[model samples]
Target: MSKILIVGAHGQTARIVIDRIISETDDSLVLFLRNSSRLNEYDNNSRVELIDGDVLNTDSLVSAMKNVDIVYSNVGGTDLAKQTASILEAMTKSNKKRLIFISSLGAYHEVPGKFGEWNEQAIAAYLPGFRESAKLIENSNTEYTMIRPAWMSNKDEIDYETTQKGEPFKGTEVSRKSIADFVMELLSDPTQHIDESIGLNKPNTDGDKPEWI
Candidate 1:
């Protein structure tokens, strides 16, 4: 059974993935988050280990990376590039590879039309950090796939499609469930989508902006 290390395990998508892995696979999980108490629900689970740690702490990351076959990072923060850099360094020190990082749409300015303009204004502050993160991951030698998801919703459905780095992004929004489903698919075969950045959105969700806003 593969030992998977999930950084930022408290994240919504990570929580979904954790439940899925526990129910569907024999994989063991190391759930790392700053506050492990949030995941006390998994305390009795033999297949799971909850760790109270910060991704910025390379020493903590190195300790957690021990014996891990893959790393799935569902991280959200203001300094994405900095966090990504630390993760890569920790992986190298730990002699591990394979990373799945959650990014956002427009990292490469791939979105098109008025929607693109609107999106830029929506998350203008954090866009550059994501773009820099893409560069860091791509330039590194480790096997990594950056997941750039469009506006997310709490809807309990899994209907989504993907676009490559250079392709104009499709649709307007995708459910967190859809993103979680895609992440689980990647975990099933970590060999796929290596060193690539993918964009996700729900089918038929094309719009100048998300319907909610």
Candidate 2:
């Protein structure tokens, strides 16, 4: 019966998480996306309410957050920090505490070896924003869990492991389904990683970079 708000509803990772939520729980969901037309696929889902709005607009974010119990942010890109700022402001105004955010693994420059070097070079422009967004959540009063996932793949499996914020990040290439499963686990028990940032990766993989990459 919990009401959860999902921003960046059209994202691949968000879709996976939403599917898992719909299939496993009775929780009502509010999906926030910039374009309402993109919600046609979910028209028959009674448990989902689609809200059209930009995360950069605080008023729109606040409106979407109304009566929302938990907020799941899957937004990325260079504007991520700005969007996160708006989300934090709206959540504070609405008195919503719980947040689950998706970030990238090398955002902290924690990934080591060749893959780490490659990731840094590849996303050099995006990492700073991700890092800033993480700091924003860390300093906020709300209960937040930031999930920094390793290189992702379309692999059809849900096998992954996690590393704490300060721990050295390990492994590479976790499936989107695995990340979704982890999010589902957190949704089932919100108290699991309160105010903690975690890095996720596929287990037992030993390589500098993901094979596919």
Candidate 3:
């Protein structure tokens, strides 16, 4: 069975992915999180292993990556650049090539119009971190798929559409469950999205265009 490691295990999106994996796949999962206390909320399962490690702690992260086939990261914060740097360093040192990263729609600095303005205003507090982290992943040698989702809601539904690098997909918010579904889909066939980035959004929703046009 494939060994998968998920960073930010306590996040809502992460939890959705975890539940999907537990119910649909036999692959083993290693959950990396800063806090071990929250793990108890999840049902005990033999397929799950919880590791207490912050993404910023390179040593711990590297150790946890041992024998891991895939790394799915849902980490987010104002210090995203540093955290992503640490994850990259750890994955490189471990010789792990598969990565599925969750980024924000604002990472593309050139999308024009009011939607861009809205994105800028929404992420202005953390734009630097998002931009730099995305650049690091883009330039890295690892096989990676960076998924940028529009505004996220904690809704239970898992309906959404994805747009590849060439398409424009931004505007309405998508549910965290949908993002989790996308990650699970990628995990089922990791190579399908290698060396690519994509945007996700709810269907038929119209609003300000994405800033990352």
Candidate 4:
């Protein structure tokens, strides 16, 4: 079984991915989080291991990288660029090649018009970390797949479509569960999305253009 490491494993999207992995596969998991107390919820599983550490600490990250085959980074913070740089540096030293990074949709400045205005507003509110972190990953040597999902909701549906580095998906929202499902799928098969960055969103089923257009 591939040994996978999940950074920020307690986050909403990470929780969904972890649950899916637990139910569907026998793969071993190492969950890295800032606090060990929060891990009580996932402690019963024998296949899961918990590590308490900050992603910005290269020593901690390097120690965690040992024997880890794949890494899914979900860390979020004000210093996103620096944190990602630390992780990338450690991964390079350890020679761990596969990475799945979660970024925000407007990181490429593709949102246009009024929707673009709204996107910029929202991005201004919450995208500095994702943008800088994604920049770090884009410049790294590790084989990586960066997924930027549109405004996330908590709906537990998997109905969604993907766009690759082109026009951003024209949706107002994408379910976090769907993003989790996509991450799980990527983990199961890394070859399909290697070195690619993509956008994801729910498809237009009501014959109306999504708000993000």
Best by TM-score: 1
Candidate 2 clash figure, as a count = 0
Q: Which portions of model 3 miss their true places by more than 4 Å?
A: 41-43, 110-112, 209-213
Cα displacement (angstroms), candidate 2, residue 208, comes to: 2.5
lDDT of 2 at 200: 93
Q: Which candidate number maximizes lDDT?
A: 1
Q: In order, how many clashes per candidate? A: 0, 0, 1, 0
- Residue-by-residue lDDT tens digits, candidate 3, 112-159: 467767778878978888889889998998899999888888777988
Question: In angstroms, what RMSD does candidate 3 have relative to the true structure?
Answer: 2.9
Error of 3 at 45 (Å): 2.2
Candidate 1, residues 127-180, lDDT tens digits: the string is 988989889989887899899999999999999999998899999999999999
Question: In candidate 4, which residue pairs get closer than 3 Å at backbone N, Cα or C atoms, i.e. clash?
Answer: none
TM value for model 4:
0.92
lDDT of 1 at 191: 87
Task: Candidate 2: give its CA RMSD in angstroms.
Answer: 1.1
lDDT for each candidate structure? 0.93, 0.89, 0.85, 0.82
For model 3, where is the 10-residue window of minimal lDDT? 204-213
**Per-residue lDDT of model 2, residues 60-128, tens digit only:** 989898888899998888988998999999999888999999998976778888878888887889998
What does candidate 4's lDDT look like per residue over 31-54, in tens digits? Answer: 998996797777888998899999
TM-score of every candidate relative to the true structure: 0.98, 0.97, 0.92, 0.92
lDDT for 199 in candidate 3 is: 87
